[model samples]
Every structure is written in structure tokens, then in C-alpha cells.
Target: MRLFAVLLLALLPSLGQAAFRCGTGLVDEGDWPVEVEERCGEPDYVAVYPEASLPGIGIVQTVEHWYYNPGPSSFIRRLVFRNGRLQSEDSLGYGFLPGAAGDCNPRVLNEGMSEFEVVRRCGEPLSKRVTWVASDAYSRYSERRSGLQGVYPVEEWMYEFGSNQFRRIVTFRDGRITDVESAGKPQ
Candidate 1:
């Protein structure tokens, strides 16, 4: 009984990460976006970008990032999609509960995190970009009142943690994290 109990405890983290799986193998890179959603259900967070016209392909591609918070013991999984297909996958390190204790770890910062929460966890960013959106250009959802429109605040905060490590850029709209994208390897 004790041996069985020990084995169960050891299996917990893998089990949590495997909570969502596809037939035969776990959902992985190259899996279609639809297959991922169907097997894993909805992700914890989603960041959609404006459509971009591919230079010569004449194809308009939609890119997106989906984040999943498995559990405390498991790392958050980030899935990148391009043109409705999974393009890449990354383990962004350990996950944590919302409003948890102070942590400078970037993995704790996630989409929908408020500006205050970000500062509280990771302190001020290396740089910041603020823009006043006069129209609904970046709005993901339509405004309820068509006539009531005015400039809204949008910001992008970049955190540089030095060379070869993952860097993060957090986007905020109305002071809340609308998207969190991983930048290229720190240089």
C-alpha cells in the first residue's frame, strides 16, 4: 500500500499535464488547431492577431497563441497557430494560481493579468510602449454601443531577462493584459 501511494504521488504531475490528450498520442506540435480544441477543450487563454497577407503566397494567414495552465506542478503550455494550424509548441515553465504570492518569474505572468498584477509580480519592464487607439482597430469584440466611441489606451510591455533565455512581451488594453507573446531568445 505504501509503495502504491508513493507511485501515485509521483505520477500526479504527468497526469495533470496529460489531462487533455488525443488518441494514441498526446496532442503535440503539428496537430491541427481543431484537433487540439476538440481534444483539450478550451484553453485558459487565447491571443489572436490581425490577419496578415503572405508576401507571395497571396494567402491571408491568421496567427494566434493559446495558453493552457495545467496545474501548480506542471508548466504552462503555449501553442502557436498559423492559418488555423498548429505551428509550434513550448513549455513556458511552471504554472501558478492567480493572485499568488510575489514572484518575479515570468511564467507566473499570463494573459488577462492586470497591469498592477504584472508590476507586483515582475516589477517594471525593461521598456514600455503606449498607444492611444482612436478606433476599434485592435478590438477583438464589437462594441455594444455603436455611437459611443473614443480613444482607448493600449500598451505593450517588454521584459528583457538577458541572453539566451526566453523574453516576454505583454500587451495591455484598458490596463489589462490582452496578450502575452514570447519574444525570440534573449540576445
Candidate 2:
């Protein structure tokens, strides 16, 4: 378990300077296997960490973290795998704990995080749930994608979870947010 958490952190460029989170994100599902040599590369994740989004079914995820040998002052990379697949494949970026080492695959989000920043860390939203007349809601927008690697537009945000210091980020596609909920305390 310790080794797996380390590899997840090492993947985040920002967190690269410190340790990383565990494999809190999804990995692979359906047709993709845990083939590090095939899935990792380009964009954000490598052939090793392929995520699958299937609601309550496919939630497979993997993360590469880091570890430091206090004695030798050396760093090592580790990988962790989780079952099931999420719905979104692309990630915006990630949220990390300040001084908590690398981007340790933040199992839980930190206190402050923004929609843009979340996108930078994780990828885009594959799908979302939306509702009008609600301050805390998600909107979605999409492009006319019609190819294998379709340039599908994706975005999301969390409304209820935003206030003072903490907020919920909703994802957006063209100009709307998807299904979102709150999960933090107000500043």
C-alpha cells in the first residue's frame, strides 16, 4: 500500500517536488488491461494509469507516487491500482495538501481549490448532472465531436461546496456545469 501511494504522487509535475497521493483516481476498465507499457504517455497519464468511467461499474484507477529514504535521501516511485471505473477519462489536474509532500493522489480534497485549477490537475468531465435555480449546480457544454479521438468538449464545477475558503467546483463543456455537490466547510 505504501509503495502504491508513492507512485501516484510522482506523476503530478507540481507535486513531483514532494511526495504524492495514493491511487484515489480510477485506472482502467472494459477493454483496457493494466498494461503500463501501453496506456501511459502523452496528455496527463501514461499507459500504466488508464481510467474507465462506468458509473457504479467501471471505476478502475491508478496513481504513481514517490517515497524518500530519509537515510540515503533517495526517492523511489510506486504505483497503486483500484477497482471499478469512473465516468470521466480526462483529468483537469489535481489538488494537493500544502507541504504534504508531492501531489499525493489526494484521496480527499484540500480546503481551497478552484474550477480552473481542478481542470489543470484532473482532466475534463465526461458527463455531469445539472439543475437550474440552484446556486450549487453543474452545467455542461460540448463540441461537435465525430471522430475516434473525437474532440469532445468537457467541463464541470461544484457550487454547493464553494464558500469563503472552500467551494464545490462544477465542470463545464461549452458553457454549462455538470452534476455537482458540496463537500467542504466554508471559510
Candidate 3:
């Protein structure tokens, strides 16, 4: 009986994939994002990541995470969107009520930090872009003359906290934060 209980516990996570229900509406994995939104109404939070690759072809798949908190009795449901379609759903176990957390501060941002840490500290960016940066930007001028000729991809994230707050641009190279720049003035 103990072994059977353990097996059932292990299977609990898998059971969550069995379609998402909101009120009287039902949403499945392959449903479009519009359908879920219509059923669940506007979500509490919406985060979008710029681009991702899909199978076969190189597509600009806009990946997004939609967070919904139905009520105090329901868990937080995170619906993943890939290319404007529902990809998956995850149960966050508990929901966060309004005003539960403080806003992220861009002033504390520093170099040599991980991407995840940046997001955790500064929240999601208003915009993001990946570009090819020349090696000379970070390499020594002497090395450039010595024939180190190549470019690497770098990711830039922009944050705008409104007119009262300063905007910031965070740059990442090879998945690690390399620079942070101020783009907005304090009011």
C-alpha cells in the first residue's frame, strides 16, 4: 500500500496536464491563447520573451507566460504561450495577492550577474533584443590589431519604470550580464 501511494504521488504532476478548467470553460494544451484569455478573462500578470526557435523552420515564436489567480481557493496557473498558441500549463501551488511584493530596483544592478538573477532582482524587461557584438568592444585594442576578428551574440534588455523612475539597459554576453547603462533621467 505504501508503494502504491508513492506511485500515485509521483503521478500527481503528470495528472495536471489533463486540461485546464476555468469556471465552466475548458482549455487544452493545443488551444490558442485567445481562447484561454476569453475563458479566464484578463490575467494577473503577462510576461513575454522576444523570440524562440520552433521545429523545422526558424520562426520568430513569441513566447509568453500568462499568470492567472482565480481566487483564494485556487492555485496560481501559469499558461505558456508559444507562437500565440497555448503550449503548456503549470500550477504554482499558491497565488500571490495584489501588493504582496515590492517593485524591482534597477539601482542595485551590477555586472557579472546571471540572467536569472537579473530578472529576479529587476523584473522582466519592457523590451529585449539579441545582436552580434564585435569582440573589440570587450577585448583590448592591442588584441584587435593582433587579428582577433570575430563577433559574438549579446542580449540587451530595456526597462522603463515611468517618468518618475530612471530607465535602464542591461546587456548580457554569453548568458552573463556584462554591462548596465542608464537611459532615462530622474524626474
Q: Best-fitting candidate, measured by TM-score?
A: 3
**Over 4 Å off, model 1:** 1-25, 51-59, 98-187
| Candidate 2 C-alpha lDDT tens digits along 1-187 | 8888887776666543333232443333321323432443222222222222333444233322111111123222223323322212222223333233333123333433333333334444323443222122111121112111212323344433224544454543323234345547554
1-187 in candidate 1: lDDT tens per residue?
Answer: 9999999999987775533453344675567887888777787767665333323453244557787767679877667776677766666657767556766766777776655557647877988876645446653232332222344446798986668667898988644588888888765
TM-score of each: 0.42, 0.21, 0.47
Scored against the true structure, residue 131 in model 3 reaches a CA lDDT of 72
Error of 1 at 48 (Å): 0.6
Measured with C-alpha atoms, the lDDT of residue 36 in candidate 2 is: 30
| Clashes by residue pair, model 3 | none
lDDT of 3 by residue, 42-134 (tens): 877776654433234543345577777654576767777766778777765444455445346776677875454455456778899877444
**Model 2 global lDDT (CA atoms, 0 to 1):** 0.32
- Tell me the lDDT of candidate 1: 0.65
Worst 10 contiguous positions by lDDT, candidate 1:
140-149
Which consecutive 10 residues in model 3 have the weakest lDDT in total?
139-148
Residue 73 in candidate 3, Cα distance off native in Å: 6.0
